[model samples]
Target chain A: MLAALPNPQGVSVCPRRARWQLDLLLLALECVDLHASELMLQVLRELQLQGMIPNRVVFWQIRCTNPFRQVTQRTPLPLAETKALTAVVVQVARRQTAILRHLLLVLDQLQAQNLPPETYAPLAAYLDRFRRNFRKRMNLQRSSLFLYKNHQALNELGLKLLAQLLLCAGTKGMERLWFSLFDGEVS
Target chain B: MLLQRQYSLPNCTLRIEGLSGQAGAEQLDIVTCCEWEIIGQNQRIKGGKDFLVALLNSVPAAAQTWLSGVKLRRSPQYPIQVEIAAANQVSLHIPRKLLQTSPEENSESPTNDEAGETLEVHLTWLQLADLVEALDQFCSDSQTLPTLIPTFHSLPRRAIAPAVPLRKQLMPLGIGAASLAAMAAIFFHFPVPERRPPREEALPPTPEAVTPAPAPTTPNPPNP
Candidate 1:
């Protein structure tokens, strides 16, 4: 039974079972060349300052010059600092299943209050590009990307959510920009 | 070694040990300069074109520069001839000025091969003097980074088709469709092997009994 579950810290970025299927979809590689995790943290902090995302989201990625090599936590970032990066991810896609009671409300909020697609297209495109590149340890075991094991796998939940967020933001930016040029308000 | 040194000769040659992308990994061969050029260009050649170019190219700064990426200036007045000889190796014939002996302090004598050819300290002291000067003068303003070239690769993210085990509500229909298709494929791919009719081979045909009664009667009559 235990053998069936993926090794939580397997050296492989993606699981072996899903390789054939996953390899077929075109995803961009988001390579951050810096050895320090601080670089991504800085980007997160910058986004936080702008109120782009909330301060509680999960962020996980493998690091190494040769990604085929294993990813041990060679350079550990402090929890307080890493919290900010997590927040950045959550800011865009905040409809966690645990927050179920407020999911619809949050969805409404996004629909009503978020900036139109035109305003953030470039940044959205960049983030989308980041997501496409490099393999993620996409544990099909759970949709939420939990830090711990024993999580239930959902039917393509968070991935679709994150993808939607990136796409919407890009589309929203374009809409906002073009509309603003005409001095128009988004419907 | 001493004789080769005294005679102003070079022994070691450069060759391709291996090619990079083969499954077994590349083996670098110490070949002649011409062979090196051909190998570098990825054209196929056999034998000592490697060592010939190695020895001959080393004779002049201009010739060496052509082989090496470094830039050099030399006196054009005397040109040297580099040739490949009987053993399929290169020979460098120099005009004496290019050959300079270094101070042989704390140095061991050169080793020799079976052909009585000893290892020559290919580049002598005076021969390497201008190398430092050339590097300092020329390579001073090279970039901070080694010049990053962009690399393109194929990496797919999600499956081209939807994942298995769809929502619970859709399972029955999916399973029914799948099982029917599987049965259809099995029927088409494999017709019944030898026996088309399953019922015909159930029982074996019966054999007729031999008439021992007639033989018995005839034997009894003969005995009486």
Candidate 2:
């Protein structure tokens, strides 16, 4: 009988908190989209392929967000524009993945060289942790679109790992060689 | 101005000089690389016949084998001689400014001490290998080099160090140290005036009898 008395005010029909929840979801999606577009994995892959990176470097996914969903989130877009964006993202991702595979091969060779413990241990730990965490996070939700909500933290993780790799590699002159060669190759 | 090319490796330094006016009887179309002089070691040969003998004697057999791959020209239009003068020491004499001129034409230019410019590079063995390869490629295709002649003239004279007397070198340092000591003694030994409490005579009068000023009355009525 007490619950039935609430209908007298009629304020309960529209739940304001539900709208706020939707806004929060959109905000998170937008944040993930912004961060994914700025991901430096492609650039890092290029460096790795060119033999600049001394340590084992890995990126979980080149494009962490679904490109099609990211483009269609807010603004109404022509189907052609969305398709084109998706195509370009897919192409870039494929190339980046290829380069990453090549880099992994090179890393395998470096490991076979039996580099000192000072060099090997940190790289092994980094690869293991990154792979484990990335897999867990990406698989957390069955939904494809919402999986990238945590990408900002993932980007920070990548940058920290890269700095650590550089510290462990002791690759001062080697990077110069790679950069100089890259410049020449580009020119 | 003589441009001296100094290359630094991890363990040693390489100093290369073109044939100075005093280095040879004739401008031999040769540049020389030599290690820095050691404190107690015998001086290396200064003549042309065995300028590299001392350096050649010092390298490991592997490096010597690598050296053999490099062709040493008897009378290269421009030749660089590599030498090791002491343990872990390397010296290179690179004939500069002779781009492709014959010895006769090269002699027309002033000796390496006067007009030649030196290029100094610091690198490891790997970098050195890369440089050697680059140089080899450049030498093989000298005809492609544009502005070969005027490039040397554009180099500034400041690249060469000016001769300084030993007394001149020591004078400024001594003066600086003496000034520093004088400043230190002045700072430490100079009398520090004791900080005394302010005397009552020097104190400003305190307003002991002063009362707080009355709040001013406003002429205009407060806006309601």
**C-alpha TM-scores of all predictions:** 0.16, 0.18
Misplaced by over 4 Å in model 1 are A1-29, A32-39, A47-136, A140-171, A174-187, B1-224
Error of model 2, residue B12, in angstroms? 7.2
Write the residue-wise lDDT of candidate 2 on B82-173 in tens digits.
44221112344444332323334334322343435422122223223323322222223323221221110111223222245458999999
Query: What local lDDT score does residue A16 receive in model 2, on the 0 to 100 scale?
Result: 24
lDDT of 2 by residue, A104-173 (tens): 3334345357542124443444344553445443343435425434644443333232321221122121
Off by over 4 Å in 2: A1-115, A118-187, B1-3, B9-14, B19-30, B34-224
- C-alpha positional error of residue A51 in candidate 1 after TM-score superposition, expressed in Å: 12
What TM-score does the A-chain of candidate 1 achieve? 0.23
**lDDT for each candidate structure:** 0.28, 0.31
Tens digit per residue, CA lDDT, model 1, A66-135 = 1222232333333232233223333322222122212222332333456432234443343333343422
